[model samples]
Target: MVIAIGFEGSANKLGIGIVDTKTNTILSNCRRTYVTPPGEGFLPRETAQHHKSKVLEVLKEALAEAKLSQDDIDVICYTKGPGMGGPLQVVAIVARTLALLWNKPIVGVNHCIGHIEMGRNVTKCENPTVLYVSGGNTQVIAYSRQRYRIFGETIDIAVGNCLDRFARVLKLSNDPSPGYNIEQMAKKGTKLMSIPYCVKGMDVSLSGILSYIESRAPGWLDQGECTPEDLCFSLQETVFAMLVETTERAMAHTGSNEVLIVGGVGCNLRLQEMMRLMCDERGATLYATDERYCIDNGAMIAVAGALEFETGQSTKLEDTFVTQRYRTDEVFISWRT
Candidate 1:
């Protein structure tokens, strides 16, 4: 059995997970998210500090839960980017330190692949049109030619960031997550107000929607024209509909019968419902994992890294650098071959 430990803290949440590849079991997974006050988002610097302070404690907890010592682990894995620079570095540095200390080979896994692999593993979907959405990324991906090809994606700000910023505008609580609060508030909405529906083919642009909503919100509330629930409900309806539309397009174009949604935003129940309806209409299946696997967690990184490690993909100590612009298609998927 191949046992690997994964460290993931690309953004606000710091997670540690242990996976056993032989049985496809996530032995241990623990996460701690750094939330900012209302009307604010987590900063890259302080978020890094939070990870640095808590990384060791989380790792210890995971190891205990997994009932494994450092000697039982075969590999060390860390998310190698397309995330906040500061937060990414802390995880990478910790991974590097642990790799050296334990004398384990380190594998740098793509954050996007982490989500995709975990989703596929949990859902038992062999091949599907993947809609990956998160704070930093939004992409419609399909595995073709041994690559997770990007068919469509956000051109500007990510969908989750747009939601978080809108939540800030509404002064929603960020205790658990801004998106969750927005989703809850949206449930209270009676009317679905109008919002700009901008879908340039499969690619989406959320920044414009965010800006327009921000501009009109104060005025609308002052005029007693709309409630915060209305705005939240409308925003969710519009954006999620856009996402479902693009995902369905990808499924149709690829002739894929299964649609897998991954990333932090994948935990939204309303989004899941919308996607499910679209899939049912098309006679395709919608596959998604629960928040434990859907939200940014170490299990994803461990699973993806374990696959790469089996194929002899190991990152040298000097090559363990993280970057904010690593595209999903850059990493060659050798396991597929």
Candidate 2:
């Protein structure tokens, strides 16, 4: 049994996963979320602090669940960049220390690529165009030349970020994550309220819609005109439509017949339905993974790391560093070799 351990502390979430390479099974996975104060902007230092404090607990929990120990692990995998520098650094330190202590190989995986690779592994999709929507990202991606290329992305704020900000504006519960609350609200919504939908070329503009929703809050509340559920449903419909459109366009442009949805937002059933409908109409297949592999987790990282290690892609202590904002195109495909 080839056991690989993965650590992800890229955003406000800390994750650890253990995978068995031989069976391609996730033995254990755990996630701990850090809260951001209401009305406060994202602070990298605060995020890092949260990771520093809770990562150990999460790691221990994952190991216990997997019924394994540090001695049983073959390699350590950590997210290298395209995330908050502070949080990334915390995980990087843990990964490096463990690798050195165990004299094992350490692999640094790209956060976005981890999402994509996990999508591929779980869905078993062959060369599909991926729609990656998360708190920090919204992109249409395709893998080529050993790297995942960004075919289209948000021109402004990410889709998940937009939803989070909107959720905050409505005084939605921040606990258990705002996205989950929005999803619950959306289910109760029956009315269709119009929201702005803007997509320019391959990129999208979510900031504008966020602003529009905020401005109309007073009016919507005063008249008892729109229930929170209605608002949630409309928001999901508009934002998800834009995502589906962009993904379809990418699929068309690339002449790819398959679509795979990944990332945190990909767990939304409405979004999945939209993409599935689009693919069905186009005579293509639509693949989506469950929450276990869809959200940022360690199992995906372990699986990704095992693949990278097999291809001789290892990170050096001197070279490993956190990047608050790394581009997807910056990763060179070392796995294909």
**Least accurate 10 contiguous residues by lDDT in model 1:** 189-198
| Predicted structure with the largest lDDT when compared to the true one | 1
Instruction: List lDDT for all candidates, in order.
Output: 0.93, 0.86
- Per-residue lDDT over 196-290 for candidate 2, one digit per residue giving the tens place of the 0 to 100 score: 88999888999999999889977997899989889989999999999999999999899999998889989988898988899999999999987
Error of 2 at 279 (Å): 1.1
Q: Global CA lDDT of candidate 1, please?
A: 0.93
Q: Among all windows of ten consecutive residues in candidate 2, which has the lowest summed lDDT?
A: 34-43
lDDT of 1 by residue, 1-337 (tens): 5899999999999999999999889999999999899999999999999999999999999999999999999999999998999999999999999898888999999999999999999999989999998888999999998899999999999999999999999999998999999999999987777789989998999999999999999999999888999899999999999999999888889999999999989999999999999999999999988889988999889999999999888998999999998999998998885
The TM-score of candidate 1 is 0.99
